[model samples]
Target: MVFFFLSGKFDQLQHAEPLSAIKTAFNQYFFNISKSDDERINTTRSSILETAGDCIRVLTACFPGLEKIIGSHCTNPTKVGPKETQHRFEYAFRSMVKAIATPSNPVVLFLDDLHWADAYSLHLLTVLATDAYSLHLLTVLATDREIKNFLFIGCLR
Candidate 1:
């Protein structure tokens, strides 16, 4: 899920004169760039790295940090094995719980190319739907095929 504080809080800042306010907003909300040591050059490389880190954090929360397992065990069954998939599902449950418990900020999770997800991922999505209402969270799952499973279909009901 993605959270947006009221737009009004940011709109004025974004449109302020001299663009200093906008720059400040970007710096504070997005990144903690060095203020004293360097010229303020907008670096796309740094921005990309920062965003990737944020994405990793969200994913780690979602699956209780299973990316490491996937990386470590792509070839070694003893290391990652089928249990890694189950751990990912558990992580999703934890993510939902954490988001719901936070209470203040809305959480947004984006699951892209869900068609590539394994059975455990689908199971996690099912569990998420059940606990979804308790959290101020939004999950976006993108897939090429129509998902017709009962767990998903029932969520819309």
Candidate 2:
């Protein structure tokens, strides 16, 4: 099994960026899988790029500059309602992650210090958590010892 350590902790010196953990995770997946000459990795890499690009184009607000990372153009697509677009974004990301994980090679995403994650990041995490039951994927989340907002905890449940 392959493990991808995705940290949600923001640098204290810099401002918290939206989708930083997601971007970092995708970037790691993009580069790491691209290095292999194996046919399965090649196919998985292409799947990740295509699905992630489609979703990122729709979700540029949450993932600024992400299209460039995936080598996609920042073209304006036909606008859909925000809620519909968000659903598409979440579904696409779920598909991308599923493409990487197989019975022989499961993927683990370790997200640390999730309390510092932005609202959009938390929403995406919740979506992934809800879908994890069906995928060969495991998500490990860590937060500070003291959670200031019980509402945030409630929402994640």
Candidate 3:
């Protein structure tokens, strides 16, 4: 989704790397208390949670997992256009989020520093935000007001 817009073409994909300046502070407080699920998922989510080691395990585990499946288009990927990958990324992200969320526990999906996020990421956010009612999601997006305005303007077109 990430691209260098030196020209008017979609250029580079977002590198599958660790997010160093990670974690977003929420304005709305989340109560971590939830009913216990009858079936617990065996996810290593606790390791890369918004803790001191958040970005550490993400590089080796989380981001790679996302990149592997969602970023699977390898045949002249740059020339394939944005629509192709946006749906795939959104589906993968939604599935992952849904799998981790339960009635007892809600999912807090936060994307920070969105000014640097790729087009696909932005597109995914637009999709998720539009369909927020269907999912048990608390989506928090962070960016400068100017960038938000720009995104809004671009989205309208």
Candidate 4:
């Protein structure tokens, strides 16, 4: 079995990456397969963009691959209620995880230092974990044993 490990370490560098874990995972996945011109990958890219064009447009600034996949013509997503916005993010991320992970070659996302992880990263983790069973993906999270930061823990609830 092939296993891909994506590790994102959250440290004191707050200015380094805003959404550390999410940025790390997304960029890592894209970077690894960026050279491929496979038809299936192209199809997945198109499907993701068609299904979540607005969300992808918002994310292009963060993930460069989105811009390459969907081009620069995408406009800002329509302004929606908070719940609808959250749903869009969730759906986009779920599609991304499914695109990369497979039963034969599982992907593992290891996010360390949850205490230092931003609220957005923790929220994204919670969203992915909520749909873990269907994604065929594994997530490993770590933080200081003393549990000084309860923010990430609270996100699970």
Candidate 2 off by > 4 Å: 1-16, 38-41, 46-77, 132-134, 146-151
Which candidate leads in TM-score? 4
> lDDT tens string, model 1, 1-157?
3252211011222222222222232233233222322432233223222333323333333332233222222221234456664564355335433432244545445544343444444555566567645366555665555644333343334
lDDT per residue for candidate 4 within 56-133, as digits (tens), equals 765666678656655688777889999887787677677667656767757888888878887777777777778854
lDDT of all predictions: 0.38, 0.62, 0.37, 0.71
At residue 118, candidate 3 shows an lDDT of 54
TM-score attained by model 4? 0.75
In candidate 3, what are the lDDT values of residues 83-135, reduced to their tens digit? Answer: 64445444544454453454545665555555555554555556656764426
RMSD of each: 14.9, 3.9, 12.6, 3.1
Candidate with the greatest lDDT versus the true structure: 4
lDDT by residue for model 2 (35-102), tens:
65577565664655665655655644444433333444556556799988778878767776676666
Better by TM-score, candidate 3 or 2: 2
Better of 1 and 4 by lDDT: 4
| Residue 127 error, candidate 1, Å | 0.7
Provide the lDDT at 152 for model 3: 33
- Sorting all predicted structures by lDDT, with the top scorer first, yields 4, 2, 1, 3
